[model samples]
Target: MNVIETAIAGLLILEPTAYGDDRGFFLESWNRRRFADFGLDLEFVQDNHSRSAAGVLRGLHFQDPNPQGKLVRVVNGRAWDVAVDIRAGSATFGKWVGVELSATNKRMFWVPDGFAHGFLALEDDTDFLYKCTSYFEPANEHSLQWNDPILGIDWPLDGLEPQLSGRDRVGMPFAAIATVA
Candidate 1:
């Protein structure tokens, strides 16, 4: 596995070495020692999966009290994934990083706990999967507006309007999120 660092601290893009034969391919999705060697010492407690249509956009979401560090990937089809730094006094607060995750490329994105996460499906049906460092507690979850002008996320909508959930449509404005400068 090749782990690449992003401009934002704790965010990593990992590329696995896939061995393909006449039938299909095989790759190591997770390895405790290997990941630890690279200084990623996450203990995932839950795994989540979702399927979304092309225009569907989920999140810019995070759990405040119990923030979840996520290792995300696209099992089928494609998605444009994003992670935004929301740590109260971090150097990159309010900044973000985006990456295209696809089944073909088999890339994995690591979003650490201090950030909000979201994704846009680039294909008709996309299977999104992730390993979470913490168990989800709905009451602790919060959403940051996906289209917040302050963050200025350049979502590659490709002429289509993003289809958002009621919760996401009414997310907190970036400026309104209480954080110490």
Candidate 2:
């Protein structure tokens, strides 16, 4: 796997080497030993998958008390995945990075704890999969406004309006959220 580091301290974009032929293709999405070599000694307790139609926006969500570090990827279609730093006192606080993930690209994004994470489906039936380092705690989950002007996330909405959930629609503005420490 080729690891690409983002501007933020721990965020990473991973490209797994794929071996293919006329028959099919093979790649290891996660290998403990290999990842540890890259200083990612992760222990995932949960795996989640969601399928979204074009224009669906799921988050800018995180768990405060039980923060989760996520390894996310797209398996069926394309998505614009984003992460924003919310670590208190960090130099890059409020800074964000966006990357395109798709079945064709086979890229994975490592969103460490202390960040807000979200994705925009660019095509129908986009399958998003992720491994979480910590179990989800709904009571501790918090959402950051996806369109907050202060954060200024450049979501590739084109002309289509983003379809958000009730919780997301009422997400807190950047100033309102408690920064992760």
Q: How much lDDT does each candidate structure score? A: 0.94, 0.95
Query: How many clashing pairs does model 2 include?
Result: 0
Name the best candidate (by lDDT).
Answer: 2
Candidate 1 to truth, TM: 0.97
* Model 2 regions lying over 4 Å from their true place: 178-181
Please give each candidate's TM-score.
0.97, 0.97
Instruction: Give a tens-digit lDDT track for model 2, residues 1-181.
Output: 9999998889999999999999979999999999999999999999999999999999999898889999999999999999999988889999999999999999999999999999999999999999999999999998999999999999999988899999999999998764424
lDDT of 1 at 90: 88
Where does the lowest 10-residue lDDT sum fall in candidate 2? 172-181
Cα lDDT for residue 32, candidate 2:
98
